[model samples]
Target: MNAKKHSTLDHALDNYSTADFLLSDHFVNHQLEPTPETALLWETWLAGNPPNRHEWDRAVYLLESIRLGLSHYAGQVISEEAIEALLARIRETNRQYSVPVRSIGRVRWMAAAVVLVLSGLLAYWWHGRHDSESYYAERMAGLQSKYTERVNRSRAVETIVLSDSSVVRLAPGSRISFNPSWDGASRVVYLSGEADFEVTRDIRKPFLVYANEVVTRVLGTQFTVRAFDAEGKVLVNVKSGQVSVSKDDVPEKGNVQDASGLLLLPNQQAVFSRRSEEFSKSIVSEPRVIGVENEMPSFEYDAVPVTRVIGDLEKAYGISILYNREQLKNCELSASLKTETFEEKLRVICTTINADYQKLDGQVVIHGGECR
Candidate 1:
């Protein structure tokens, strides 16, 4: 945390992003258990800081919608009648106003609430439930989805191809599940442990990976998601193309502003801290060439400037390398990097140029004193 963030308690209430507030431990704890002290803190905070009121309301509404959706998703039938009634009344209002129902799904309307009362956080009986409630509620009631599961428990990687020709490299002790017969808007897969996905191109049907509490969305991209039980965190790293990863609690289409987690380009990674419900993003520590086993690129350079070497690497790995060009403009390097990994190449180049490299949000930033 920076000094600005660390001093937020005595500073402005709305200094943080909406996501920071939504995913904070304090907010979630207060939402889940608003004891007298918690209630006092939030109520007093909300009353004093008028600017934060809107964000507070949004956070609450988002949490409620997510709780409801997850309840339905996990086959928990707690307040179906009340929630449905609420949806019905909202739909009726939309009809009166002549509002077109969004073709997206029920999750959209879930953000609507005429009344601003916080829905009680109630636990459910997960005794014998075995299906995604919201996903199957409308479809299964009308016979629209067919699903299957694939698990790899051996000490070797397993390749599983989906009906859409999307390829999955399922790591040992991992499971990748989806409908065997696919006829849906998107190719949805529930993953546990780690798996590398090479999705087939179908912009009409984007691919979605649900791992732990984070949802990774991509269209015809290659990426990797890791959410093993022992890790207690979700990690998403994009190999090529773009990928959007957001927490399940936050609205997928968060308002008109797109205020959520992040959209990662190649070599970017997002890590979700389960305990704090916070997201931390950075460049991948070691990005490799995106290709099959036999198609890795070769790297060779002879007395080349650092710029040329890094440029070749950037093209090979599909990741951005940022640096002060003038500082290292005169630096030269001569090395064969074909056998080295992405990080190895970076280290070699940095050492040769007497420079240092750090992975920033989604790019590698080079730092060095002026080369003599």
Candidate 2:
């Protein structure tokens, strides 16, 4: 590759850090077209970056594995374009025909593809043959050699305190493994199930949790992660502080602009669907008062204009409540809601005002006609 071409390819590869992007139709069609130029581009790019070679190799392994599996099924080797088209067709078939694809055991690189091919015409016979938990166990086997592993086999939640005084509450059937020494630039833990974490404040070393295909990063925060191996979704719910959630496969190369993910604040949650390779942000089911207990504001209202009432609620919970100020200008609410939950308060207020509220994109939006 020429210098200009190499530089362009390098810039593009830096952004294509996630395996999902690499496996997408755009990447397959343009970069893996079996042309000599494409081959040279990848060869030069891979040879230039020794540290990221493993990422390239892993993507290649997944692509070839999918190709070989499809070839074995069709009795002929398929081209990259053909593979992309077939995968798209399979996804559409799944949506149209409701043909469920089971997850594979060893590698979840291209989970949908691997499972669809291995199932062979959507057979239910392979349902219980391989366990997804084994895949997680095998993936963490290498780290287990150097990390401390904690499993909560009991019915109750288990409490674990890390070396940095970070607390982790592992739910039943959950497991977490981490380095005890805390010598790295970041505090990392591998999780396979559900856990609530209260990380100690450390601006220098951000805390990272690897849960299935999703990764949750925080400087210091309280959050819950539910990522069971057999489940199709990974959830990160922030209770306090901020979190950056993204696909675990995305490589961090010291460029903030190159990163693609969701930034979650208190009471915000992110859901990652393994099948769609998508992330969705929303408000948590239950939102609590945001500030310190002693400085908490009262939720009492005395025939106050509905706008002021909503403003108080927004300040108390640190959530956005949307409503037209002009329409609700004549509305008044009188209630002592200090004991009520977040949703309960909204329900009570909406009921009194003959209004209804809907959650949209992590905010509560009220819709109602102007009161007389």
TM-score of each: 0.55, 0.63
Tens digits of per-residue lDDT for model 2, 1-372: 322442112333334333432333333444334564565455444434434566554454344344434443353345657766876764443333221111222232454355445434322222233554343565565454668899999999999999999999999999998889987788888888999999999999888888887788898989999987545568899998899988866423212224578999889999886656789888886688888877676778888888888988888888889988898889988889989988888888888889877665678888884677
Clashing pairs in 2: none
Clashing pairs in 1: 73-133
Please report the TM-score between candidate 2 and the true structure: 0.63
C-alpha displacement of 138 in model 2, angstroms?
A: 5.1
| Model 1 lowest lDDT segment of ten | 118-127
- How much lDDT does each candidate structure score? 0.64, 0.69
Off by over 4 Å in 2: 1-135, 142-144, 251-257
Worst 10 residues of 2 by lDDT: 97-106
